[model samples]
Target chain A: SLSTSAASESDADELQKEQQARSVLRENFLRCLLSAASKNVQFNMYEKVKMEAKFGACDIDVLNFQVSDLHTPIGVQKEALIRSQDVISFTFEI
Target chain B: MEGGWPLLGPLQWVRYVKKQVKVKVGRNEEVRGWLFTVDPVSASMVLVDFMESEGTLVQVVMGHAVEEVQVLKEPDRKIADRLQSMFLPPRTSILDP
Candidate 1:
Protein backbone atom coordinates (compact mmCIF):
# COMPACT_ATOMS: atom_id res chain seq x y z
CA SER A 1 0.00 0.00 0.00
CA LEU A 2 2.79 2.45 0.83
CA SER A 3 4.54 1.65 -2.44
CA THR A 4 1.33 2.20 -4.36
CA SER A 5 0.80 5.55 -2.67
CA ALA A 6 4.36 6.63 -3.46
CA ALA A 7 3.94 5.61 -7.08
CA SER A 8 0.71 7.54 -7.32
CA GLU A 9 2.40 10.65 -5.93
CA SER A 10 5.19 10.27 -8.42
CA ASP A 11 2.75 9.91 -11.26
CA ALA A 12 0.90 13.02 -10.17
CA ASP A 13 4.13 14.99 -10.04
CA GLU A 14 5.08 13.74 -13.45
CA LEU A 15 1.77 14.81 -14.90
CA GLN A 16 2.14 18.28 -13.41
CA LYS A 17 5.61 18.56 -14.85
CA GLU A 18 4.35 17.55 -18.25
CA GLN A 19 1.63 20.18 -18.21
CA GLN A 20 4.05 22.90 -17.17
CA ALA A 21 6.48 21.87 -19.85
CA ARG A 22 3.79 22.05 -22.49
CA SER A 23 2.84 25.52 -21.32
CA VAL A 24 6.42 26.66 -21.47
CA LEU A 25 6.84 25.17 -24.88
CA ARG A 26 3.80 27.08 -26.07
CA GLU A 27 5.10 30.36 -24.73
CA ASN A 28 8.56 29.87 -26.17
CA PHE A 29 7.28 28.77 -29.54
CA LEU A 30 5.04 31.84 -29.88
CA ARG A 31 7.76 34.23 -28.86
CA CYS A 32 10.20 32.90 -31.43
CA LEU A 33 7.66 32.70 -34.22
CA LEU A 34 6.28 36.17 -33.51
CA SER A 35 9.69 37.75 -33.16
CA ALA A 36 10.57 36.38 -36.56
CA ALA A 37 7.18 37.19 -38.00
CA SER A 38 7.13 40.77 -36.77
CA LYS A 39 10.77 41.17 -37.74
CA ASN A 40 12.03 44.61 -36.66
CA VAL A 41 9.26 46.59 -35.05
CA GLN A 42 8.12 48.18 -31.80
CA PHE A 43 5.71 45.38 -31.14
CA ASN A 44 5.16 45.39 -27.40
CA MET A 45 5.17 41.67 -26.74
CA TYR A 46 2.16 41.26 -24.55
CA GLU A 47 2.10 38.16 -22.33
CA LYS A 48 -1.52 37.35 -22.96
CA VAL A 49 -2.18 34.76 -25.66
CA LYS A 50 -5.50 33.34 -26.92
CA MET A 51 -5.09 29.83 -28.23
CA GLU A 52 -7.28 27.02 -29.65
CA ALA A 53 -6.76 23.79 -31.55
CA LYS A 54 -8.43 20.67 -33.00
CA PHE A 55 -7.55 17.38 -34.69
CA GLY A 56 -9.47 17.96 -37.91
CA ALA A 57 -10.66 20.77 -40.19
CA CYS A 58 -8.48 23.73 -40.99
CA ASP A 59 -9.23 27.06 -39.31
CA ILE A 60 -8.06 30.40 -40.68
CA ASP A 61 -7.86 33.89 -39.21
CA VAL A 62 -7.06 37.03 -41.21
CA LEU A 63 -6.75 40.64 -40.14
CA ASN A 64 -5.50 44.02 -41.40
CA PHE A 65 -3.77 45.99 -38.69
CA GLN A 66 -2.63 49.57 -39.23
CA VAL A 67 0.35 49.82 -36.90
CA SER A 68 2.35 52.45 -38.76
CA ASP A 69 3.48 53.55 -42.18
CA LEU A 70 7.26 53.77 -41.88
CA HIS A 71 7.53 51.35 -38.98
CA THR A 72 4.80 48.91 -39.74
CA PRO A 73 4.62 46.59 -36.77
CA ILE A 74 3.14 43.23 -37.52
CA GLY A 75 1.22 42.80 -34.30
CA VAL A 76 -0.61 39.51 -34.14
CA GLN A 77 -3.58 40.20 -31.89
CA LYS A 78 -4.66 36.56 -31.57
CA GLU A 79 -4.63 33.43 -33.69
CA ALA A 80 -5.43 29.72 -33.65
CA LEU A 81 -5.56 27.05 -36.33
CA ILE A 82 -6.08 23.30 -36.34
CA ARG A 83 -6.20 21.02 -39.33
CA SER A 84 -5.14 17.49 -40.07
CA GLN A 85 -4.48 16.80 -36.40
CA ASP A 86 -1.98 19.68 -36.17
CA VAL A 87 -2.14 23.18 -34.78
CA ILE A 88 -0.96 26.67 -35.80
CA SER A 89 -1.05 29.43 -33.17
CA PHE A 90 -0.06 33.14 -33.00
CA THR A 91 -0.37 35.95 -30.47
CA PHE A 92 0.70 39.59 -30.11
CA GLU A 93 -0.52 43.07 -29.15
CA ILE A 94 -1.08 46.26 -31.10
CA MET B 1 2.67 49.52 -39.61
CA GLU B 2 2.43 47.84 -43.00
CA GLY B 3 -0.82 47.34 -44.86
CA GLY B 4 -2.39 43.90 -45.29
CA TRP B 5 -3.70 42.02 -48.29
CA PRO B 6 -7.34 43.05 -48.00
CA LEU B 7 -8.03 40.18 -50.40
CA LEU B 8 -10.90 42.39 -51.63
CA GLY B 9 -13.87 40.04 -51.85
CA PRO B 10 -14.09 36.49 -50.56
CA LEU B 11 -14.17 35.23 -54.12
CA GLN B 12 -11.04 37.16 -55.00
CA TRP B 13 -9.46 35.88 -51.83
CA VAL B 14 -10.26 32.32 -52.87
CA ARG B 15 -8.92 32.78 -56.39
CA TYR B 16 -5.61 34.30 -55.28
CA VAL B 17 -5.13 31.70 -52.58
CA LYS B 18 -5.74 28.66 -54.81
CA LYS B 19 -1.98 28.41 -55.41
CA GLN B 20 0.39 29.72 -52.71
CA VAL B 21 0.69 33.17 -51.25
CA LYS B 22 3.82 34.93 -52.48
CA VAL B 23 6.16 35.55 -49.59
CA LYS B 24 8.41 38.53 -48.82
CA VAL B 25 5.83 40.62 -50.64
CA GLY B 26 5.08 44.20 -49.64
CA ARG B 27 2.47 46.83 -50.43
CA ASN B 28 0.84 46.25 -53.79
CA GLU B 29 2.11 42.73 -53.43
CA GLU B 30 0.20 40.74 -56.01
CA VAL B 31 1.15 37.11 -56.36
CA ARG B 32 -0.96 33.98 -56.63
CA GLY B 33 -0.85 32.01 -53.41
CA TRP B 34 -2.85 29.55 -51.32
CA LEU B 35 -4.84 30.89 -48.36
CA PHE B 36 -4.45 28.59 -45.42
CA THR B 37 -7.51 27.23 -43.68
CA VAL B 38 -6.64 29.11 -40.47
CA ASP B 39 -10.02 30.10 -39.13
CA PRO B 40 -13.63 30.50 -40.14
CA VAL B 41 -13.33 34.28 -40.32
CA SER B 42 -9.65 34.91 -41.10
CA ALA B 43 -7.27 33.30 -43.59
CA SER B 44 -3.68 32.24 -43.12
CA MET B 45 -1.12 32.05 -45.94
CA VAL B 46 0.61 28.80 -46.75
CA LEU B 47 2.07 26.64 -49.52
CA VAL B 48 0.17 23.45 -50.38
CA ASP B 49 1.84 20.47 -51.99
CA PHE B 50 0.65 20.37 -55.57
CA MET B 51 1.01 16.61 -55.84
CA GLU B 52 -0.88 15.37 -52.79
CA SER B 53 -3.06 18.49 -52.67
CA GLU B 54 -3.05 17.75 -48.92
CA GLY B 55 0.21 17.68 -46.99
CA THR B 56 2.96 19.70 -45.27
CA LEU B 57 2.13 23.37 -44.79
CA VAL B 58 4.29 26.36 -43.97
CA GLN B 59 2.17 29.13 -42.40
CA VAL B 60 3.52 32.34 -43.85
CA VAL B 61 1.88 35.37 -42.30
CA MET B 62 1.07 38.37 -44.44
CA GLY B 63 3.48 40.47 -42.42
CA HIS B 64 6.26 38.15 -43.56
CA ALA B 65 6.05 39.88 -46.91
CA VAL B 66 8.81 42.46 -46.99
CA GLU B 67 9.46 44.06 -50.32
CA GLU B 68 10.02 42.04 -53.47
CA VAL B 69 7.80 39.00 -53.72
CA GLN B 70 9.87 35.83 -53.43
CA VAL B 71 8.12 32.98 -55.17
CA LEU B 72 9.91 29.67 -55.43
CA LYS B 73 8.69 27.69 -58.42
CA GLU B 74 10.42 24.34 -57.97
CA PRO B 75 9.57 22.63 -54.68
CA ASP B 76 9.14 18.86 -55.08
CA ARG B 77 5.39 18.63 -54.62
CA LYS B 78 5.72 15.00 -53.60
CA ILE B 79 8.22 15.79 -50.88
CA ALA B 80 6.38 18.90 -49.86
CA ASP B 81 3.25 16.84 -49.37
CA ARG B 82 4.98 14.23 -47.28
CA LEU B 83 6.83 16.78 -45.19
CA GLN B 84 3.69 18.81 -44.53
CA SER B 85 2.09 15.92 -42.69
CA MET B 86 4.53 16.61 -39.89
CA PHE B 87 2.46 19.64 -38.90
CA LEU B 88 -0.69 17.71 -38.14
CA PRO B 89 -2.46 16.48 -34.95
CA PRO B 90 -3.33 20.05 -34.05
CA ARG B 91 -2.36 21.22 -30.62
CA THR B 92 -2.23 24.82 -29.45
CA SER B 93 1.32 25.42 -28.35
CA ILE B 94 0.93 29.16 -27.92
CA LEU B 95 -2.17 30.66 -26.46
CA ASP B 96 -3.55 33.44 -28.63
CA PRO B 97 -2.66 36.83 -27.24
Candidate 2:
Protein backbone atom coordinates (compact mmCIF):
# COMPACT_ATOMS: atom_id res chain seq x y z
CA SER A 1 0.00 0.00 0.00
CA LEU A 2 2.87 2.39 0.74
CA SER A 3 4.49 1.76 -2.68
CA THR A 4 1.17 2.26 -4.43
CA SER A 5 0.63 5.58 -2.66
CA ALA A 6 4.12 6.74 -3.58
CA ALA A 7 3.48 5.87 -7.22
CA SER A 8 0.28 7.90 -7.22
CA GLU A 9 2.10 10.84 -5.72
CA SER A 10 4.67 10.76 -8.49
CA ASP A 11 1.92 10.56 -11.06
CA ALA A 12 0.37 13.69 -9.63
CA ASP A 13 3.71 15.44 -9.83
CA GLU A 14 4.08 14.48 -13.48
CA LEU A 15 0.61 15.73 -14.26
CA GLN A 16 1.33 19.06 -12.62
CA LYS A 17 4.51 19.47 -14.62
CA GLU A 18 2.63 18.74 -17.80
CA GLN A 19 -0.07 21.28 -16.97
CA GLN A 20 2.58 23.93 -16.38
CA ALA A 21 4.16 23.22 -19.72
CA ARG A 22 0.81 23.34 -21.46
CA SER A 23 -0.10 26.69 -19.98
CA VAL A 24 3.19 28.27 -20.99
CA LEU A 25 2.94 26.95 -24.53
CA ARG A 26 -0.68 27.95 -24.88
CA GLU A 27 -0.02 31.48 -23.62
CA ASN A 28 2.79 31.98 -26.11
CA PHE A 29 0.66 30.64 -28.94
CA LEU A 30 -2.16 33.00 -28.04
CA ARG A 31 0.29 35.90 -28.14
CA CYS A 32 1.39 34.79 -31.57
CA LEU A 33 -2.18 34.79 -32.81
CA LEU A 34 -2.76 38.20 -31.30
CA SER A 35 0.27 39.65 -33.05
CA ALA A 36 -0.88 38.20 -36.34
CA ALA A 37 -4.21 39.99 -36.26
CA SER A 38 -4.86 42.44 -39.14
CA LYS A 39 -1.70 41.42 -41.01
CA ASN A 40 -1.64 39.78 -44.44
CA VAL A 41 -1.13 36.06 -44.03
CA GLN A 42 -0.20 33.48 -46.64
CA PHE A 43 -1.83 30.12 -46.23
CA ASN A 44 -0.45 26.96 -47.74
CA MET A 45 -3.14 24.39 -48.30
CA TYR A 46 -3.57 20.87 -49.48
CA GLU A 47 -3.07 19.96 -53.17
CA LYS A 48 -0.46 22.68 -53.41
CA VAL A 49 -3.05 25.43 -53.16
CA LYS A 50 -1.89 28.78 -51.77
CA MET A 51 -4.02 31.73 -50.74
CA GLU A 52 -3.53 35.05 -49.01
CA ALA A 53 -5.90 36.87 -46.72
CA LYS A 54 -5.91 39.49 -44.04
CA PHE A 55 -5.50 37.74 -40.74
CA GLY A 56 -8.48 37.81 -38.42
CA ALA A 57 -9.07 35.32 -35.63
CA CYS A 58 -9.00 31.62 -34.97
CA ASP A 59 -11.61 29.72 -33.06
CA ILE A 60 -10.74 28.33 -29.65
CA ASP A 61 -10.86 24.86 -31.08
CA VAL A 62 -8.43 25.93 -33.82
CA LEU A 63 -10.75 24.40 -36.34
CA ASN A 64 -11.53 27.52 -38.39
CA PHE A 65 -9.84 30.78 -39.26
CA GLN A 66 -12.00 33.85 -39.82
CA VAL A 67 -10.38 35.97 -42.49
CA SER A 68 -11.15 38.99 -44.66
CA ASP A 69 -10.55 39.81 -48.32
CA LEU A 70 -9.59 36.23 -49.06
CA HIS A 71 -7.77 36.24 -52.40
CA THR A 72 -8.68 33.24 -54.47
CA PRO A 73 -7.76 32.50 -58.05
CA ILE A 74 -11.16 33.46 -59.24
CA GLY A 75 -11.87 36.53 -57.12
CA VAL A 76 -11.74 38.03 -53.66
CA GLN A 77 -14.29 37.18 -51.02
CA LYS A 78 -15.20 39.99 -48.66
CA GLU A 79 -15.19 37.66 -45.67
CA ALA A 80 -14.70 33.94 -45.22
CA LEU A 81 -13.88 31.20 -42.81
CA ILE A 82 -11.07 28.91 -43.86
CA ARG A 83 -11.23 25.44 -42.47
CA SER A 84 -8.06 24.59 -40.59
CA GLN A 85 -8.02 21.10 -42.02
CA ASP A 86 -7.49 22.51 -45.49
CA VAL A 87 -4.47 24.49 -44.47
CA ILE A 88 -0.97 23.10 -44.03
CA SER A 89 0.66 26.29 -42.79
CA PHE A 90 0.25 30.06 -42.65
CA THR A 91 2.80 32.86 -42.43
CA PHE A 92 2.65 36.50 -41.36
CA GLU A 93 5.17 39.25 -40.83
CA ILE A 94 5.62 40.75 -37.37
CA MET B 1 6.56 13.02 -36.58
CA GLU B 2 3.68 12.32 -38.92
CA GLY B 3 0.68 10.64 -37.43
CA GLY B 4 1.71 11.17 -33.82
CA TRP B 5 2.54 14.84 -34.07
CA PRO B 6 -0.81 16.15 -32.99
CA LEU B 7 -0.97 13.59 -30.25
CA LEU B 8 2.33 14.61 -28.76
CA GLY B 9 1.28 16.19 -25.49
CA PRO B 10 2.49 19.50 -24.18
CA LEU B 11 5.22 17.88 -22.15
CA GLN B 12 6.73 16.38 -25.27
CA TRP B 13 6.19 19.40 -27.50
CA VAL B 14 7.77 21.79 -25.05
CA ARG B 15 11.02 19.92 -25.44
CA TYR B 16 11.38 21.45 -28.92
CA VAL B 17 11.06 25.02 -27.80
CA LYS B 18 14.01 27.49 -27.95
CA LYS B 19 15.65 25.46 -30.68
CA GLN B 20 15.87 25.70 -34.44
CA VAL B 21 13.76 23.23 -36.33
CA LYS B 22 13.10 22.16 -39.87
CA VAL B 23 9.54 21.10 -40.43
CA LYS B 24 8.39 19.14 -43.46
CA VAL B 25 4.83 19.88 -44.40
CA GLY B 26 2.39 19.14 -47.20
CA ARG B 27 3.90 17.72 -50.37
CA ASN B 28 7.43 19.07 -50.57
CA GLU B 29 7.55 22.19 -48.46
CA GLU B 30 10.14 22.44 -45.74
CA VAL B 31 10.11 25.33 -43.26
CA ARG B 32 13.14 26.23 -41.19
CA GLY B 33 12.96 28.62 -38.30
CA TRP B 34 13.56 29.07 -34.62
CA LEU B 35 11.10 27.07 -32.60
CA PHE B 36 8.90 29.38 -30.57
CA THR B 37 5.93 27.54 -29.16
CA VAL B 38 3.55 24.75 -30.01
CA ASP B 39 -0.12 25.23 -29.22
CA PRO B 40 -1.13 22.58 -26.73
CA VAL B 41 -4.72 22.40 -27.94
CA SER B 42 -3.98 22.00 -31.65
CA ALA B 43 -0.32 21.04 -31.53
CA SER B 44 0.36 23.72 -34.13
CA MET B 45 3.91 25.06 -34.13
CA VAL B 46 4.79 28.76 -34.16
CA LEU B 47 8.17 29.35 -35.83
CA VAL B 48 10.04 32.61 -36.11
CA ASP B 49 12.36 33.54 -38.97
CA PHE B 50 14.52 36.62 -38.55
CA MET B 51 15.32 38.40 -41.77
CA GLU B 52 18.53 40.18 -42.64
CA SER B 53 17.01 43.55 -43.43
CA GLU B 54 14.23 43.99 -40.90
CA GLY B 55 11.15 42.46 -39.35
CA THR B 56 10.53 38.80 -38.55
CA LEU B 57 8.37 36.19 -40.23
CA VAL B 58 6.17 33.98 -38.14
CA GLN B 59 4.99 30.69 -39.57
CA VAL B 60 2.43 28.36 -38.10
CA VAL B 61 2.33 24.79 -39.33
CA MET B 62 -0.76 22.83 -38.51
CA GLY B 63 -0.13 19.69 -36.53
CA HIS B 64 -2.04 17.40 -38.85
CA ALA B 65 -0.08 18.57 -41.86
CA VAL B 66 3.36 18.04 -40.40
CA GLU B 67 5.22 15.11 -41.91
CA GLU B 68 8.50 15.40 -40.09
CA VAL B 69 10.33 17.68 -37.67
CA GLN B 70 14.08 17.89 -37.46
CA VAL B 71 16.10 19.78 -34.91
CA LEU B 72 18.68 21.85 -36.73
CA LYS B 73 20.27 23.89 -33.98
CA GLU B 74 19.88 24.98 -30.40
CA PRO B 75 19.36 28.60 -29.58
CA ASP B 76 22.11 30.68 -28.06
CA ARG B 77 21.50 33.06 -25.20
CA LYS B 78 20.81 35.98 -27.55
CA ILE B 79 18.50 33.98 -29.79
CA ALA B 80 16.62 32.58 -26.84
CA ASP B 81 16.15 36.07 -25.50
CA ARG B 82 14.89 37.29 -28.84
CA LEU B 83 12.45 34.45 -29.22
CA GLN B 84 11.03 35.00 -25.76
CA SER B 85 10.57 38.71 -26.31
CA MET B 86 9.14 38.53 -29.81
CA PHE B 87 5.54 38.84 -28.70
CA LEU B 88 6.10 40.77 -25.50
CA PRO B 89 4.64 44.24 -25.23
CA PRO B 90 7.05 47.16 -25.13
CA ARG B 91 8.26 47.72 -21.62
CA THR B 92 6.86 50.77 -19.87
CA SER B 93 8.95 52.78 -17.44
CA ILE B 94 7.75 52.34 -13.90
CA LEU B 95 10.46 54.48 -12.33
CA ASP B 96 9.74 57.58 -14.41
CA PRO B 97 7.29 58.91 -11.87
Candidate 3:
Protein backbone atom coordinates (compact mmCIF):
# COMPACT_ATOMS: atom_id res chain seq x y z
CA SER A 1 0.00 0.00 0.00
CA LEU A 2 2.90 2.39 0.69
CA SER A 3 4.32 1.95 -2.81
CA THR A 4 0.87 2.44 -4.32
CA SER A 5 0.36 5.71 -2.44
CA ALA A 6 3.78 6.96 -3.50
CA ALA A 7 3.05 6.16 -7.11
CA SER A 8 -0.28 7.95 -6.95
CA GLU A 9 1.29 11.03 -5.42
CA SER A 10 3.92 11.20 -8.16
CA ASP A 11 1.22 10.80 -10.77
CA ALA A 12 -0.62 13.75 -9.28
CA ASP A 13 2.49 15.87 -9.42
CA GLU A 14 3.14 14.91 -13.02
CA LEU A 15 -0.43 15.80 -13.92
CA GLN A 16 -0.10 19.22 -12.35
CA LYS A 17 3.12 19.89 -14.25
CA GLU A 18 1.47 18.84 -17.49
CA GLN A 19 -1.49 21.13 -16.85
CA GLN A 20 0.77 24.10 -16.13
CA ALA A 21 2.72 23.52 -19.32
CA ARG A 22 -0.51 23.21 -21.28
CA SER A 23 -1.88 26.48 -19.93
CA VAL A 24 1.26 28.46 -20.72
CA LEU A 25 1.53 27.04 -24.21
CA ARG A 26 -2.16 27.59 -24.89
CA GLU A 27 -1.99 31.22 -23.70
CA ASN A 28 0.86 32.06 -26.06
CA PHE A 29 -0.92 30.34 -28.92
CA LEU A 30 -4.07 32.35 -28.26
CA ARG A 31 -2.04 35.53 -28.37
CA CYS A 32 -0.47 34.47 -31.64
CA LEU A 33 -3.93 33.85 -33.06
CA LEU A 34 -5.07 37.25 -31.86
CA SER A 35 -2.10 38.96 -33.50
CA ALA A 36 -2.82 37.17 -36.76
CA ALA A 37 -6.26 38.72 -36.98
CA SER A 38 -7.04 40.66 -40.19
CA LYS A 39 -3.78 39.58 -41.82
CA ASN A 40 -3.54 37.88 -45.17
CA VAL A 41 -3.06 34.16 -44.61
CA GLN A 42 -2.52 31.26 -46.95
CA PHE A 43 -4.01 27.94 -46.06
CA ASN A 44 -2.46 24.67 -47.30
CA MET A 45 -4.95 21.87 -47.36
CA TYR A 46 -5.11 18.25 -48.44
CA GLU A 47 -5.41 17.14 -52.05
CA LYS A 48 -2.97 19.89 -53.05
CA VAL A 49 -5.60 22.54 -52.39
CA LYS A 50 -4.21 25.94 -51.50
CA MET A 51 -6.09 29.18 -50.90
CA GLU A 52 -5.49 32.64 -49.55
CA ALA A 53 -7.81 34.55 -47.24
CA LYS A 54 -7.89 37.24 -44.65
CA PHE A 55 -7.35 35.68 -41.25
CA GLY A 56 -10.48 35.84 -39.18
CA ALA A 57 -10.77 33.40 -36.31
CA CYS A 58 -10.48 29.80 -35.28
CA ASP A 59 -12.86 28.16 -32.90
CA ILE A 60 -11.75 27.40 -29.36
CA ASP A 61 -11.62 23.73 -30.21
CA VAL A 62 -9.79 24.51 -33.45
CA LEU A 63 -12.37 22.56 -35.36
CA ASN A 64 -12.79 25.17 -38.08
CA PHE A 65 -11.24 28.35 -39.41
CA GLN A 66 -13.38 31.34 -40.28
CA VAL A 67 -11.74 33.25 -43.11
CA SER A 68 -12.80 36.18 -45.30
CA ASP A 69 -12.37 36.63 -49.05
CA LEU A 70 -11.25 33.10 -49.65
CA HIS A 71 -9.59 32.83 -53.06
CA THR A 72 -10.25 29.58 -54.82
CA PRO A 73 -9.32 28.40 -58.29
CA ILE A 74 -12.89 28.67 -59.47
CA GLY A 75 -13.88 31.97 -57.88
CA VAL A 76 -13.51 34.12 -54.79
CA GLN A 77 -15.72 33.52 -51.80
CA LYS A 78 -16.52 36.45 -49.56
CA GLU A 79 -16.53 34.20 -46.52
CA ALA A 80 -15.71 30.61 -45.80
CA LEU A 81 -15.39 28.11 -43.00
CA ILE A 82 -12.57 25.63 -43.46
CA ARG A 83 -12.62 22.46 -41.47
CA SER A 84 -9.39 21.98 -39.59
CA GLN A 85 -9.31 18.32 -40.54
CA ASP A 86 -8.75 19.26 -44.16
CA VAL A 87 -5.93 21.70 -43.45
CA ILE A 88 -2.30 20.70 -43.28
CA SER A 89 -0.98 24.11 -42.35
CA PHE A 90 -1.48 27.90 -42.72
CA THR A 91 0.88 30.85 -42.92
CA PHE A 92 0.56 34.59 -42.33
CA GLU A 93 2.82 37.63 -42.11
CA ILE A 94 2.79 39.65 -38.94
CA MET B 1 -5.22 13.32 -34.63
CA GLU B 2 -5.31 9.86 -33.12
CA GLY B 3 -1.73 8.77 -33.79
CA GLY B 4 1.79 9.96 -34.57
CA TRP B 5 2.69 13.33 -33.02
CA PRO B 6 -0.57 13.68 -31.15
CA LEU B 7 0.54 10.96 -28.79
CA LEU B 8 3.27 13.20 -27.42
CA GLY B 9 2.30 14.81 -24.10
CA PRO B 10 2.59 18.39 -22.93
CA LEU B 11 6.06 17.97 -21.43
CA GLN B 12 7.47 16.71 -24.71
CA TRP B 13 5.74 19.46 -26.65
CA VAL B 14 6.97 22.17 -24.30
CA ARG B 15 10.54 21.04 -24.84
CA TYR B 16 10.36 22.28 -28.46
CA VAL B 17 9.21 25.79 -27.58
CA LYS B 18 11.61 28.71 -28.12
CA LYS B 19 13.94 26.56 -30.24
CA GLN B 20 14.43 26.90 -33.96
CA VAL B 21 12.91 23.82 -35.58
CA LYS B 22 12.28 22.25 -38.94
CA VAL B 23 8.92 20.56 -39.19
CA LYS B 24 7.87 18.05 -41.79
CA VAL B 25 4.21 18.18 -42.61
CA GLY B 26 2.09 15.89 -44.75
CA ARG B 27 3.97 14.28 -47.62
CA ASN B 28 5.98 17.02 -49.31
CA GLU B 29 5.97 20.00 -46.97
CA GLU B 30 8.86 21.19 -44.84
CA VAL B 31 8.71 24.35 -42.69
CA ARG B 32 11.40 26.02 -40.64
CA GLY B 33 11.15 28.78 -38.06
CA TRP B 34 11.57 29.73 -34.44
CA LEU B 35 9.31 27.54 -32.41
CA PHE B 36 7.05 29.95 -30.60
CA THR B 37 4.52 27.68 -28.94
CA VAL B 38 2.46 24.59 -29.42
CA ASP B 39 -1.25 24.53 -28.68
CA PRO B 40 -1.78 21.63 -26.32
CA VAL B 41 -5.44 21.36 -27.17
CA SER B 42 -5.02 20.95 -30.91
CA ALA B 43 -1.32 20.17 -30.90
CA SER B 44 -0.77 22.89 -33.54
CA MET B 45 2.63 24.59 -33.58
CA VAL B 46 3.12 28.37 -33.99
CA LEU B 47 6.36 29.13 -35.81
CA VAL B 48 7.80 32.56 -36.56
CA ASP B 49 10.25 33.21 -39.40
CA PHE B 50 11.80 36.68 -39.41
CA MET B 51 12.42 37.96 -42.93
CA GLU B 52 15.03 40.64 -43.54
CA SER B 53 13.50 44.07 -44.26
CA GLU B 54 10.12 42.50 -44.73
CA GLY B 55 8.34 41.27 -41.62
CA THR B 56 7.79 38.24 -39.44
CA LEU B 57 6.00 35.30 -40.97
CA VAL B 58 3.97 33.03 -38.71
CA GLN B 59 3.12 29.51 -39.66
CA VAL B 60 0.80 27.15 -37.83
CA VAL B 61 1.35 23.49 -38.57
CA MET B 62 -1.54 21.32 -37.59
CA GLY B 63 -0.64 18.59 -35.13
CA HIS B 64 -2.28 15.87 -37.12
CA ALA B 65 -0.20 16.68 -40.15
CA VAL B 66 3.21 16.70 -38.48
CA GLU B 67 5.33 13.82 -39.68
CA GLU B 68 8.63 14.84 -38.14
CA VAL B 69 10.25 17.65 -36.14
CA GLN B 70 13.92 18.53 -36.08
CA VAL B 71 15.54 21.06 -33.80
CA LEU B 72 17.78 23.15 -35.98
CA LYS B 73 19.21 25.73 -33.60
CA GLU B 74 18.76 27.14 -30.17
CA PRO B 75 17.82 30.77 -29.69
CA ASP B 76 20.31 33.00 -27.95
CA ARG B 77 19.40 35.22 -25.03
CA LYS B 78 18.59 38.17 -27.29
CA ILE B 79 16.57 36.11 -29.73
CA ALA B 80 14.71 34.46 -26.88
CA ASP B 81 13.89 37.87 -25.45
CA ARG B 82 12.62 39.03 -28.80
CA LEU B 83 10.51 35.95 -29.28
CA GLN B 84 8.98 36.26 -25.83
CA SER B 85 8.19 39.92 -26.33
CA MET B 86 6.80 39.65 -29.84
CA PHE B 87 3.15 39.39 -28.82
CA LEU B 88 3.35 40.61 -25.25
CA PRO B 89 1.81 43.95 -24.34
CA PRO B 90 4.49 46.56 -23.81
CA ARG B 91 5.41 46.63 -20.15
CA THR B 92 4.92 49.92 -18.36
CA SER B 93 6.86 50.07 -15.13
CA ILE B 94 5.67 52.11 -12.20
CA LEU B 95 8.48 53.89 -10.36
CA ASP B 96 8.21 53.76 -6.62
CA PRO B 97 10.56 56.14 -4.98
lDDT of 2 by residue, A7-92 (tens): 99999999999999999999999989989899999999898788999999999889999999999878999999999999999999
Residue A5 lDDT, candidate 3, scale 0-100: 100
User: Where does candidate 2 stray beyond 4 Å?
Assistant: B1-3, B92-97
TM-score of chain A, cand. 1 = 0.39
Across B21-84, the per-residue lDDT of candidate 1 in tens digits comes to 4544433434343333222123334433333454233343432332333334433565434333
Which window of 10 residues has the lowest lDDT sum in candidate 1 chain A?
Answer: A52-61
C-alpha lDDT (0 to 100) for residue B17 of candidate 1? 31
Clashes of 1: 37
Docking class of 3: high
Q: lDDT at A9 for candidate 2?
A: 100
Q: Residue A55 in model 1: shift from native, Å?
A: 12
Q: Rate the local accuracy (lDDT) of all candidates.
A: 0.34, 0.90, 0.89
lDDT of 2: 0.90
Best candidate (score: lDDT):
2
TM-score of chain B of each: 0.35, 0.88, 0.85
The fnat of each candidate, in order, is 0.06, 0.99, 0.88
Residue A18, model 2, lDDT: 96
Per-prediction backbone clash count: 37, 0, 0
